[model samples]
Target: MIDKAKLSALAHAVIDTEIEAVKALHERINDDFMQACEFMLHCQGRVVVIGMGKSGHIGSKLAATLASTGTPAFFVHPGEASHGDLGMITDKDVVLALSNSGETSEILTILPLIKRLGIPFIAMTGRPESTLATCATAHIDVSVANEACPLGLAPTSSTTAALVMGDALAVALLETRGFTVEDFARSHPGGLLGRRLLLRVSDIMHTGDAIPTIDEEALISQALIEMSNKGLGMTAVVDDQYHILGVFTDGDLRRVLSQEINIHTEKLSAFMTRECKTGRADMLAAEALELMQRYKINALLIENEHQQLCGAINMHDLLRAGVV
Candidate 1:
């Protein structure tokens, strides 16, 4: 086996080099960077990203980030652009090309066509005077002094710099366009972030007949039956017109049993926890989860503007909705 100390040292050195590469990017965020953002910002169509080799991989991710944040974008392989995908680009679109060496033949092959179309071209390359940079409308330098790879052959530090630059562009455009969390959630409706930001208490809560509820005058045994039937492990002790008064849970049942209280006849009000927490229907399920965690409660009743119980939710509901 290789020496453990040598391996550890190598890992730390790689991390240090990558960190420095990212740090060097701060100074390069200058006029050219803003010019690139302006071109993308003013474009009426999508931002078309093209690259070759390892730069191609980073370009794909950059396009994804730009699309998800606010700017419309997609990655077109330079090789494919030559075959037929050049049609994917339009006169209204802006092109962002990536080339660490600024000399990829495939990307260079399409540079003339892009120039002929008269669409704005932005280049992210290591060399300032390279043909690709000199041909572009704006050139954002992503040069790193060293690669994180000790061999200096792999695209580690350079790729990191490109990724960071892409994120910088995405975020700058996102803020300038007034993109909100709701807008972001619309783009990622299937992810956990979407659920946390968009899922509301009303969307998942049990409403109407599904709510486990009992009267304030109900016996302890009646609350247990309601909890069992609804399968929420708790019952809201509500009054006429469905206004919540208290809550009876399995924990209250344990107390009743330990005290040798008569479940068959004892009023649940005497044992139920009064002033139980409630949630608003419009509140985010994530917020409700926060309320539950803060108050150390498992189940919450949803109340409407009238302050009457309308629906019920539990930890299980949040978990099932992927908001836990």
Candidate 2:
């Protein structure tokens, strides 16, 4: 069997090599990088990224990062492009090609057409003197001193350098475009931050007949039925005007059990927690979650400016809405 020490040493060496490769990308962020950004920013169309094999994998991830961060971009396989996918490219789009050797036949096949369209071409290659690099409107050198693979065959450290350089390009463009959290949220509506920022109490709270509410004078038995039927673990106690007065929860019931109170005779007002914490209809669900967590409570009544209970939301509601 291979010795453990040799395996550990190899792993550490690979990591150290890739780290240095990524760090070297910082030095190449110069005039050519700025020109590539200008091309994409002024294109008025999507940034089309193309590559092959390992380079394709890196290009795919970079394309997604660029799209989500405010730049519109997508990945098209170089081989597929030669087989008709090249039609996806348009005169309005800026093409960014990736090839470690700068001589990938599939990319070269389409290079002339890319130039014929008179669109901007950005190349990321390890060989600065390569045809792809020389033909590019702006060339980004992602050359590495050595591969992380001991055989120097696998595109390890070289691919890492390209990946980091792509990220640098995307971030520089994102900052220049003034991208904001809200802008990112809009693009990722199903993500946690998006839901936390976009969803409000009014959107997910139980309203009308769905709200678990009882009159302040209602018997504890009636409140228990409301809580059980609504399954919110609590019932809001409101006056005749529907103005919230307090809330009786499962905890309150457990506390009253010690006093041996009569459910049929005792009123909710006698056991309810008065002036309970409340939230506004316009409050973000994330904010409601904070309120619940801060007070160690599980439910909250949503009200308007007049303090009238308009809706009810529980921890389960936030969970169902993916805000938890």
Candidate 3:
């Protein structure tokens, strides 16, 4: 059986080594890094990332990060590129080749075609003097002083440094392009972020007869009936023209009961909150959530451009729509 204490020490040491490897990458983000970003930013087509072995795994993640953030990119195996997949790349595209030793045979095999097509090339490698680094438009040095593996045969620290460098490049490009949260949402429409930014108050609000509303002259007992019928825990008190005058909630009933006021005799307008939060139909549901949080309220009355009550929304609605 393995000794638990020894296993724990080895795990901690591996984490510490990788952390230092990533931290060391900060100083290496220099002119070559800038040139690489510039080439990718100006490219008319996609950024094609090519790699082999363990470098391929890191390159796949780098491509995904770039695609999600604002840069258009995809991963291509260097072996496949040499076996007729090279047609997928175009002269307008930029090639980002990864080979920790800077001497992967498969990557070197495609250098001539990449050069012939006049496609801009960026190489990430550990050896600056290797052929892959020497023939590229720019070279990013991802050299680590030592591998985390005790045997020095497994890729550990070197791969971590390269992945961190890729992240830095993607983030720098994201900022330079002025990419906004809305832009990110567009790229990820099936995510919760998209639901929060894209869903509007009108899209989730209850309209017309579905809205829980009572006449301002109606008794507190009648407002309770409307709230129960709609199952929204609250009811809007509206004027004869259907313009909202106030909102009456279950909490209002509790306060009225404390005063011994007759629910049967007191009108909704007598105890309802006159100054209530209102929202516009075009407003984002996420914005409505913020307003609700700030005011410590759960419900909002929606008004159209003419200041007429058009709909209503509560925290439950936002919750069901995945906006909260």
Candidate 4:
């Protein structure tokens, strides 16, 4: 039977080897790296990435990262490119080819066509003196000293090195393009970051009759009825023009009840908290949550551009919308 300690040691060795491989990539970010970035940055069309096997998987991830971070890019298999998928590339685009050995026949097969089209080619290979590196417009070396695999055959450390290098290139280009979180969010609209950045108060607030509201002249009992009906635990006190005068919340009601105030006879204007925090219809839900947390309040009255009360939101609304 195999020793359990040996298995654990082997796992640790693999992790340590991969970590060192990634660290070695830091020194390889030379002029070639900058030249590659310049080529992609100036490309009028999309970046077409091509690779084979494990390199293809890494290339696919690299393409996605580039596309999401302000650089538009996509992956095409090297094998596919050899057939008819080469047509997907254009003169205006830049080609990024990946091959650890630097002589992937499928990638080499398309090199002549790329040269004829006068399109810029950026090659990422483990061999700096390889044919692909020599023929390309720019070359990024992702050579690794050894493989984490004990047999020295399976792509372990070398693939990890290439992946880290790809990430480094993507992030470098992202910084050069001055890409922001908002820009990244636009490309990932279905994600949580997109929801936090793009979701506005108008998108999710309780509008129309859903807003719990009462006139300033309404009795505390009437305000309670509106709050109960709206299920917001709070009611907005507004004037004839729907201008928010204050907010009456369950906390305020409790304070009033502690003073022996009669709900049927006390007007909301007399018991409501005059200094109410308000939000705008155009504000982000994340900003609204910050406002709620800062004031230790559960509800916020939303106003339109004209400064008129238009909507309202409570903690529960934000929570239900997954904005909290």
- Strongest candidate by TM-score: 2
Model 3 Cα lDDT, one tens digit per residue, 1-324: 989999999999999988988888888889999999999999899999999999999999999999999999999998998889999999899999999999999999989999999988999998889999999899999998889999988999999999999999999999999999998998887789998888899999999899998888899889988999998889988887888888998889889999999889887787999988899999999999999999999889999998889999999999999887
Q: Judged by lDDT against the true structure, how good is candidate 4?
A: 0.91
Clashes of each: 0, 0, 0, 0
**Which RMSD does model 2 reach against the true structure?**
1.6
Best of the two (3, 4) by lDDT:
3
All candidates in order of TM-score, best leading: 2, 4, 1, 3
Give the per-residue lDDT of model 4 (tens digit) for 178-243: 999999888888788988999898888989999988898899999999999999999998888888
lDDT against the true structure, each candidate: 0.93, 0.93, 0.92, 0.91
User: How well is each residue in 1-324 modelled by candidate 2, as lDDT tens digits?
Assistant: 879999999999999999989888878988999899999888788999999999999999999999999999999998898889989999999999999999999999999999998999999999999999999999999999999999999999999898999999899989999999989999999999999988999999999999898998899999999999999999999889999889999999999889999999998888999969999999899999999999999999998898899999999999999998
> What range of 10 consecutive residues in model 4 has the weakest lDDT sum?
315-324
Candidate 1: segments with Cα more than 4 A from true spot: 1-27, 145-152, 180-186
lDDT for 147 (candidate 1): 96
| TM-score head-to-head 1 vs 4, winner | 4
lDDT of 3: 0.92
